[model samples]
Structures are given as structure tokens and as C-alpha cells.
Target: RKARALLVASLLLHDFHLRFEQVRRAEVLALLRALGVPRVHEDFIFIIINFSCFEISFHPQSWVVTSLVIVI
Candidate 1:
């Protein structure tokens, strides 16, 4: 259950990081790895490619607010 929760949190953080205007693809992968999101190193390149292909916006403030809400 803990691992599952960590996975979910990692995914959420990944999405949040992606929403940032200045976040680089490499940084995202690094964040995933730092968060221990399983297989990040092996899939880093592909993940970056896929994420970069998508049209997404990063809102840093929203991310912080949402994270605080989640914590509470």
C-alpha cells in the first residue's frame, strides 16, 4: 500500500512538474527518479519524448496549493 501511494504521489508530482512553464524534459525524468517512481531510469528517454509531445502548462502556484490541500 505504501508503494502504491508513493506511485500515485509520484504521478501527481510528475503532472505538476510538467505544468511548470520552465520545466525541462530531463528535469521531469530526474524528478520521477528522485521520487522513486520505479523504472524512471530505464524509461527516461521515452517518458521525456512522450511528455514533450503533449501540450501542457505548468502552474506553479496551483501545484503548491494542490499539494498543500493534499497534505491536509
Candidate 2:
């Protein structure tokens, strides 16, 4: 039951992160456009945002799982 609760919490957090990312992406794009940044630069910024989101979502989980494996 604890595990199930954790799973549910994790799913909720993941969904929140995705929604936050979408809003953040929109805000950043708007800011860039307002500043008259070029299309190529906009694409680069988008890539960076994606990488940041990936790291935010997965890197800590990987570390925790690794530590658990080592402890076991």
C-alpha cells in the first residue's frame, strides 16, 4: 500500500512537472519573441529547455535507484 501510494504521488508529480514545463516553454518563447530573438536561437533555446526538463525528471530518480541497488 505504501508503494502504491508512492506510485500515485510520483505520477501526480510527473504530471505537474509536464504542465509546468509547458507553461514555462510558452513564457520563454514569448519572452524571446518580444526581445526579437531569431528563429535559430529560438530552436536552440527549446532544445536546452527539453534537456533541462529531462534532467529534472530523471536524473535524481536514477541516482536514488542506483543507491538502492548498491545498498541491496
Candidate 3:
């Protein structure tokens, strides 16, 4: 289940990156660096997706925790 969530997040990250402007792109990279996420790590992509506010769809319905987990 975690693998599936990571996969979806990865794809969403890719799609989001394509729409990012140069200034925002630089800012994201900087934020990642500040957070200690290495550029080469695959998890950085997932982190980007999460930070971008892309909702992850989970099964059993119970996995949905958007209402409780505040991003900021």
C-alpha cells in the first residue's frame, strides 16, 4: 500500500514539475535543500508532491486523513 501511494505521488510530482515556473522551481529546490532532502533521492519527489498539496487517494476510506493532517 505504501508503494502504491509513493508511485502515485511520484507521478503527480512529475506532472507538477512540468508546470512550475523557473522562479518557483528554484524556490522548491531551495526548500528541499533546507529540509535536508538530497536531490538524487527518489523520496524527494514524493516529498515534493506532498508539499505541493496533491491529495493522495487511499483505500478502505480510513486512510484518508486530510482533515486531521495540516500541512502548515
Clashing residue pairs, candidate 3?
none
All predictions: root-mean-square deviation over Cα? 8.8, 16.6, 12.2
Looking at model 3, report the run of 10 residues with the lowest lDDT sum: 63-72
* lDDT per model vs. reference: 0.40, 0.35, 0.37
Kindly give the stretch of ten consecutive residues in candidate 1 with the minimal lDDT sum. 63-72
Q: What TM-score fits each model?
A: 0.33, 0.29, 0.28
lDDT of 2 by residue, 1-72 (tens): 231111111222222333433445565555445545433245544664654422243443231111100000
Query: What tens-digit string does per-residue lDDT give for candidate 3 at 1-72?
Result: 232222222233322223222324455455456645545344544454456444434545222222111122
Which of the predicted structures, 1 or 2, would earn the higher lDDT when compared with the native? 1
Candidate with top lDDT is 1
lDDT for 27 in candidate 3 is 54
Model 1 lDDT per residue over 1-72, tens place = 232222233233334543344545576556556865555443544553444433333454432212211100
State the local distance difference test value for candidate 2. 0.35
Q: By TM-score, how accurate is candidate 3? A: 0.28
